[model samples]
Target chain A: MERRSKITPILLLAPAILIFVFIFVAPFIYLIFQSFWHYETSYVSKQVFTLENYIKLFSDPYYWRIYWRTFRLSVISTLITMILAYPISRMISRMPPGKKGLVTTLIALPMIGGGMIQAMGWMTMMMPYGAINGILLSLGIIKEKMTFLGTETGILIGLVQSFIPLMSLPLIASLGAIDPTLEDASKSLGASPLRTFFEIILPLSIPGAVSGMVLTFMANLTMYVTPSILGQGKIQVFGSFVYQQAISVGNWPFSSAFSLFFLLIMGVTAFLSSWITKSIQKSIYKGNEA
Target chain B: MKKFSMFLLLFVLLCVASTVIASPAEAADCNWDEATCEILDGADFGGRTMVVGVWGGTIEEIYRKYIIPEIEAHNGKVEMLLGGTSDRVAKVYAERENPTMDIAYTNMFESAKGIKEGVFEVPSADAVPAYADLYDVAKIDAYGMSFAALGIAYKPEAFEGEPDWPDLWKPEYKGKIAMSTFPGSDSEGFLTIAGYLAGGDDTTPDLAFPKLAELKPIPLFFANLDELFMMMDKGDVVAAAVFDSYTRTYIEQGANVKFSYPKTPGAIVTMDTLCIVNNAPNRDMAIAWAQMSLSPIVQEAFAREIYFGPTNSKLVLDEEAASKVIYGEEQANSLIRMSTYMTDHRDEIVERFNREIAED
Candidate 1:
């Protein structure tokens, strides 16, 4: 029976493990290996191991500019998404059960159409003669049309809009799990609403907030379509740059190296974020003990 | 159970009767010798299916309307994989060993790369009878189907007269002209034009970049033909470096656009080639399809319908149709062909373009 139980779990997990190995792990390993190869042309790559691809990336100031731009835009977009998501999620968490579901669905409606559809929607509204410009013109906000296409500002707006749901769902889950009586207890003890929120609610929601930020930041970091469509090939963010190298220029080795470096940056950022979250929670617990 | 079986019998009988009635009508209309038809009468394909990769939109529509029926008449099936040249080339490379496509339509540069990588079968007069009818330029790496001359396409209302390539540098047109992305055929043409204007030929290609940057036109970079047309129609851009074939289509569709082949050096020519995959599954059908595509009838139709300069030397168009395309030997000779230069310096050129012109 013990052997059967062990075998049963392994069997049940076999399909998932096989899928992960083939789809994710194998490709990831190949990508790393490919980064070490030398690119010859579009359809040709030599297998002789070399670090030329990485050297090329590090040597060029153009690549550095692109990487720094990608980082700055991702950070700004994630921060804005988190700031907007928190209050909305908190409001929904405190709502009546029926109303909570309705509000939650409304929060997630933009995401239901997927990223490409949302990007296209924004494209329709953000074009020079689009609805946004028309509205602004009617209201006499400006005499001339504003250039939204091929600008970093336009890409930032797209990133924040698309990633807001990713930030909100985790926050809503964590906030909803909090016991209402704890807030009531603090209130009954003469703590102000703002004070109770700072002392109790905020600290308890750190994990969810951290998770949301990490996911949104990671997503925005590798964003391709939104930036490419909104940026119109001028912005040249990290994701689109990789695409230009891999697909357009047919420099697979260079693209692979670029991707691996981007992976390292994302890993470090995620690690630092989690470490900071842990430190904050430790301090909050120590304060309570005191 | 009896009623269900009777209904099934009736449905099967109906389907058989419909096909039986449809086959003869289709077969009778098949003109075997016609260049536009897909199949010869009495030739049995044994139900073989040929997959063709071609550009979508009007091109694919024309093929479906005129070509597929004849193939179907001879018991052959055709499946179309519609996408850009790069998309199709990437697929062919990824599946090189056992390619999913039988025939792929690609630009000259990509076709050259494919030939170098041993991804395509070299065409010969024996394999494709229409090979005899192609010009020397069209017979290089693959069977060239059509060519387009690149020039300035502008709004008729925006300018008093036809603008030359140097007019792109004028201060008034800054931030108003759109160009295709670097590493694309259109941009490569623009680079060559810039090089010519700078008094540098293919040998001194580097001089073109500085000249291009001097224009300082913060142009919208179009990723596809559809986007270029959309921006032009919406008046988001006033002018662009575009192909004659595409601009002609837009003008016919009443986009208020006019294309001018610059008088000083004339337009640059880009060719689209059709090649069979190295290990294509349906080799015979693939060869036949390639031959049919280059047939005089099809070539003439393409020239008339889409303003594509037909690769078949025998194809003769009317004066009006010939005016829109690079038709004769004189026009062909005058047009700049940059296939060799582009193939050699494509990587450096794209990298520099991204760094300087596109980013700036």
Candidate 2:
């Protein structure tokens, strides 16, 4: 019976494990192998191993610019998303249980519509003759219509709007997990509301904030649709560059190499951020104990 | 037991005999010698299915509305795999060993590339009868289904006269023109135009890069046709190097856009070609579909409906339709066929474009 219980759990997990191996692990291994292959021409890749693809990528100033731009935009968008999400998450966290459900649903509504739909919505609003410009014109904010469709600012707006929920949901969970009695005790002890928030609530929510930032940052880093649509092919983010190489240029090996490098960079960044956040959380908890 | 076995054998023999007798009756009763007439009369395809890789949006809608039903009437099924030209070509390459799509529609440059890679089967006159009737410019390795003249699309209010290709580089049009990105047909066409202006032909195409860079304050690079037209209509862009067919569509929809073929070298014509994939499952059906696509009736419909210039020399459009397209032998002769050169240097062109033009 004990053996049966153990075997039963394995049997239940078999399908999931099989799926993961086939879908994720297999493709990842193939991608790595492909990155080493030599590119001859469009639709023609040689199996001969070479580091020429990597060499070319590193030597090119254009690729370095794109990588730097991608990281900068991602970091900026994540920061902006966090700033916008904190107050909303806090409000939802403090709401009564029934109302909190409604508020959370409202906050998650944009996600339910999917990224493409939201992007199109933003495109309509951000176009020169679009609603935003119309309002700006009517209100006499500017003498002429502003061009937002092909600018980095437009892309950043799209990134933050699309990823705000990713930042907020985790924050809401972390903030809600905190005991309300702690705030009450701090207030009774003659602490200002702002001081209580900074000293107690903010420190406690670090875990959630870190996770949220990581999620949003990673998403923004790999963003393709929003930048492609809003930036009007003017913006060459890393994801779009990879797509251009693979599809448009038909350099699969080169694209694979580029993707591998992108993965390495993203992996290193994610690791460092997670490590720093964990260290901060540990130190804060240790200090609280003292 | 012996009696039962005899009866079973008799039943099998009877079924085989019936099938043999019925097969010839189901065969199409049309003369194969007269290909155009045969297509008009329709031919039975023995219930085969042809999967076509083509562009989506209105193009797909037009095919579904006018073309697919005709194939269906001939007892054939058509499954469409719709995407951009590059996407369809990529799929063909990925699935080269066992191709999922039987027929792929791509631009002349990509078609030439596919021909070099051996992804596409070399089209034969016997397979596609309409191949003989197409203009010389349309007869690449693959059969050209339609053509679009690449020219300047400008707002009338912004300019007094039609702007030539070089006029876009003028100070007045700086930051006012929209340009299509590289690895696309429009950009390739513009690059050739730029090359011509810089005193270089297909031989010294690299000279175009420096000239393209000179057209400064760097024009907006539009992602798609919709965005280009929308930007033009919004006055964000005053002029763009665009296809005549797209400009016509926008004009018909009241976009206040005017398309002009530059007088200096005429328009740079881009051909959309159709090719049968190598080792295609439905080879005969794919050939038949290609024949139908290049037929006069379908060509006329495409020209009339979508403003796509017909490649079939036999196609005679109405005055209105002809006005919208680059029709007749003169226009066809004037078309600059840059497929060979573009195919050879596509990688360098795209790389340079990204590094120089796109980055700037």
Candidate 3:
């Protein structure tokens, strides 16, 4: 009976494991191997052992700037998404079940409509003569039309809009798990609303907020379409840079090296963030015990 | 005597039968006409699909009308893989060993590089007889499909008249000048012109970078014609370096833009070439497709539709159509092109462009 159960589980898991290894693990291994290969063109690579690709990446200050800028912008976008999602998540958590579901779906509209479609939408409304400027100019908010499409500001707007749902869903889930009476008990104990939020609600919601921020941050980190469309070729994010090298210039080895490097950084960032979040949670737990 | 007569008759009959059977096979691949290129009697493709990689828009439409249907009529199927030149180039190179794309259209520089790398098959007159019908400039180891001159596409309201390349530096149009992305014909042409303006030709092109930097804080680096035209219409972009074909196409669509062939150095010549991938699945079909593509039928179709200058020397357009496109050898010769140094340093130059021009 024990052997049959084990065999059954293995059979059930075999397809998924096989698929994951085939699609994800195999390609990842290939990517690592290719990064070390010599570049002949974008598509053609020689299986020679050389670190020329990494050497170029490390020596070039331009790549360093691009790396730093992508990290910085992703951090900024995550913080902004967290700030915007908290209030919306709290409000949705307090709503009736039917209303909550509808509101959540509405919040997810940007994600559902897809990244490309949303970026394009933002583009039409953010151009110099686009709707945003048209309305602002009509109201005499500014004498001249403001440029948004080609700036970091435009890309930020797009990133925040796209990632807000990612932040909100987790917050809503964690917020809904919080006991409503706990908030009332804190209020009854003569704690103010702000104090209740900081001492009780905020601390309790930290896990959800962290989850949301991590999701949003990762999304922002590897962003391609938003930056490509909004940046108007002025901005070079990691994704766009990889695409430009691999597809546009046909420098695959260098692009693969760049990608592998980004992946390593991403893994480190994920690990560091997880540790930091855990530390924050432990400190909050100690404070509550005291 | 009867036996001798019988043997003689049999010999004559056998000779006549053998001649009939061998004549058709010999005449099948003959490319007879040199004036107007027509599809030659070639092997039936057994209804197999020949994958073609080319640009989508009006270019695809012209191929569908003039080139694709002819292949279909010859028991072949043509599947179009539409995208930018770089995408096609990447695919052709990647799939060089066992290529799915039988034929691909690419820029002259890309085709040249591909030919050098042996990813694309070198064109020979024996393979594509229509090769002989193309102009001298079109025979760049691959079949030249179209010619478009790189020039300024400017809003009429911003300029008093046709603006020269140097005039783009007028302080008033500082942030108003849009540029195309680097590692492309348009950007390279603009860079070459900038180098020329700084008193250095393609051979001595050291001063180009600083000259391009003068137009920094660039408002836009347009990837497509629609985006550029939208900015131009909005008055956000006063002028931009663009291809005459794209500018003319947009202008006909009621866009408020005009193309100018800047003097002192004139317009830069940009040729689009059709390449057959090496070790392609359908070599015969790809060759036939090449014949149809380089023929005057498709050439005239492109000239009529999007004003793409015909590479086929035999193609003769009416006066009205002739005035719009790069018409004769005189006009074709007037357009300037940079040397292979641009292609040689393309990777490094692209990185430089990313750092200096594209990045803020």
Question: What is the Å distance of residue A21 in model 1 from its true position?
Answer: 1.6
Candidate 3's residue-wise lDDT over A5-91, tens digit each? 989989999999999999999999988998899976546679999999999999988898889989999999999889999999999
Q: Which ten residues in a row have the lowest lDDT in candidate 1 chain A?
A: A243-252
Model 3 reaches what TM-score against the true structure?
A: 0.89
DockQ (Cα-based) for each candidate: 0.48, 0.57, 0.48
Q: Point out where model 2 deviates above 4 Å.
A: A1-5, A140-145, B1-49, B73-76
What are the per-residue Cα lDDT tens digits for candidate 1 across A200-246? Answer: 89988878898899999999999999998888878899988888777
List model 1 lDDT by residue over B109-157, tens digit each. Answer: 7887788779998888788888888988888887888889889998777
lDDT of 2 by residue, B1-360 (tens): 999999999999999999988765544433223685455463687888889999887778877876788778778899999888889988999999889799999988778778878999887787778899998778867798888888999988888888888788888777787788767888878888888889986556678888877775554787677777777776768888889887898889887789888976668878899989999998877877787788787788788878898988988887978988878767867877675776566567678787777765
A-chain TM-score of every model? 0.94, 0.95, 0.97
Give all candidates' CA lDDT scores.
0.84, 0.84, 0.86
Per-prediction tally of clashes:
0, 0, 2
Give all TM-scores, in the order shown.
0.90, 0.90, 0.89
Best by DockQ: 2
The DockQ score of candidate 2 comes to 0.57
lDDT tens per residue, model 2, A1-290: 99999999999999999999999999999999898898877757999989998899999888888899999999999999999999999999999999999989888999999888998989989987889899999999988988777688999999999998999999999999999999999999999999899889999999899989999999999998898878777789988888888888788988898888999999999999999988988888888789
